[model samples]
Target: MSATRTGGRNGERPVDPEPLPHPVVDNHCHLDIAPYAAPDEPVPVAQALARSAAVGVPRIVQIGCDLPGARWARETANEFDAIVAGVALHPNEAPRLDAAGRLDEALAEIADLATDPRVRAVGETGLDTFRTGPEGREAQERSFRRHIELAQDLDKTLVIHDRDAHADVLRLIDETGAPNRWVMHCFSGDAEFAAACLERGAYLSFAGTVTFKNAQPLRDALLAAPADRILVETDAPYLTPEPHRGRPNASYLVPLTVRAMAAVRGADLAELCRAIDANTETAFGGTWGA
Candidate 1:
């Protein structure tokens, strides 16, 4: 994701929120993208992990949306006990690669990287109408279909990134068949849409966007979701939670979103945390970083 995509304050990182009552996994995060810092500043992967763990986010699933990112995520997961990797070519990227005649080559590399033990999921791959225009839709759908098939064949969790393309996402899933384990990452749909995903056996992951004042429909979806199938994420460097909504985000800020979710769902904080943790493991195909 681009650092400027979410329109965050960028000057100051948000203060850490109170720790969660129990630990929960950040089911999706882009540790490689540090929008808060400058180009010369190294990505503080270790520091990010420590801060998040201090606030009860002990594990994270680092997602790689392109070639270099896929490699970085794999390498980072191998180095950090608290992280696992998810690899794919983002929907927007697919068109560019296709235009350059590199889409096939890129997907081939993603396939290779995804087989690693440290890589638990194959995605962040799905339709994204908000960014890519009509000209790119075909390439996006083609990529999404390939990633879906790849996930099933490899027995890895399929993590989808649906943005303003919910109907097409569900249609593609129905056409290709959902995998044994899949997630609607950073779920941006309403109660009815949530029901559609849940019916298709998806783990709906709420991100910091859930805390936005304008996100009543998202909150309703949270309330409508069953606890067992719910998950949480930061999608950091983007979608920073409210109160800190226009600021650079990191996993340490996850508690803010989780707390908001509990409030919306009228669920106990600790119980919600526990369910999210377990749901993440299930969504990602078991535990790591023990």
Candidate 2:
């Protein structure tokens, strides 16, 4: 029950990241950075992998932020029987403006990273307007489009991150005429945005944040979403659900979110579990623990 910690950035030994006692699917986590150190510090990848398996997350997709993270995501996933990989250049991780000339090349590197067999999805890519201005927004969009195209080309599921820019995100999805079968991970949009994404045939993923009492509006949106299109994730080492709200989040904590989902949709926990388990498999193209 000790908190995990990692070597500073790339060289420190991370804290113990043991798994938990619930059936869970960690749809998204930066395996290379699972909160081992202080809030802003990086968690050692090894601990993250071990912790994921220890918890009963039947399947997990560890995402990468850059080239090295890409390699590690694949290698670590390949090593673990239950872990899978998702590679993408996170919006803020993309190179800065002056060096933005390398953005396309950087994103291409990520797409190439997805070519690995263990890589079942293509992002954590999308807009992050909450923190970025116009220029950064433009860069995020450029990178996001490529991620979508890569997923389409590889026939892999797209993992989208739509924060406050839901409208623009929808516009881009329409413009790309991107194929259906993507996942809107950690869906924070309102009922309207949920409708827009559902219209595009994109799958919706719910996280622990939806369990908060103040998140009833979010629950309302979840209620509006089609059950088949719904999925669940720990999004851990972040967004831990109620009861464990302030605790360090992990895949094991997903059942709480699952329970919350059940409460929101008025379904039984077992049925809710089955629904999301199926949705998780579909989101990853039926590639579970393989």
Candidate 3:
């Protein structure tokens, strides 16, 4: 994927900040897509991983929203001790696959990938009303439900991507009986919705968007979320946090968002980092060890 599609639209990667006092995992990132890299070239996975580790973000859950990406993720995880994988057919991709009558085949591939030990989660899957219209919703929902079942049956964590379809996303999860471990990835919900998801034992993973000035509601939700249930991600090279809002983001830039979240919740930065670290391990089952 081009850097622009991965969050490198500005063609400028933000300078790395000082490392955090405690180690933390970037629960969600796309090292393969290299959003925080040059326009045509991905930031090499080794480079991204090293840069992140230098700054105290030692581990990452590499998400692959399609088959090729899933393959990349699995191979990458197997090759690198610092990374784990999550595989799924994205909600937006579902309708297109269904239209081409290939959704089932694609899903079968995802199911097979889900069983791989290095692939700890099934995700970047859920509803996306912002992009897909009513015409594509049925396929999206069908895909989401299937992924949920796959996650449950395989006993892998379910990583969700809800965008402008909060109510329906919650409804479906409730209707299907959510997997034992699930995450609201790049969580974009209010306190009420946070409470709802927390009630279902979902971990809320906040991304750089939480640092936007207008995202106080997100900050409020962060405050509302229990300490042990919170995790942080770059979701890079997108949602770059404040001070670098429009620039390319990377896992190394996670401290900016973590600091913002700490301030919002009136908590000590190191304590929050430790909590998120533990929360991430719990959410994904364990760290990716060589």
Best prediction by TM-score: 3
* Model 1 vs truth, CA RMSD: 2.3
Model 1 spans with C-alpha error above 4 angstroms = 1-9, 37-39
Each prediction's whole-model lDDT (CA): 0.89, 0.73, 0.89
Residue 7, model 2, lDDT? 23
Q: Any idea how many clashes model 2 has?
A: 8
lDDT of 1 by residue, 172-269 (tens): 99999999999999999999999999999999999999988899999999999998999999998788899987778889999999999999988899
TM-score of 2: 0.85
Tens-place lDDT digits, model 3, residues 1-290? 32324444565777888889899999888876755446567888888889989989988899989877888888888888889999999899999999999999999999998889999999989999999999999999999999999999998999999999999999999999999899999999989989999999899999999988788788889999989999999887778888988888889999888998989999999999999999998899865572
Q: lDDT for model 2, on a 0 to 1 scale?
A: 0.73
TM-score of each: 0.96, 0.85, 0.96
Cα error of candidate 2 at position 270, Å = 0.9
Tens-digit lDDT track of model 2 for 1-290: 12222322222222323333335577887655545336455445555545555655566777765666777777878887778888887766663722558887777677778888888988877877887777676678778888878888998888888778888888888888665579898999778878888888988889988988788778988999988888888666667677656556656566667777887889866666666767878888775655
RMSD of each: 2.3, 4.8, 1.7
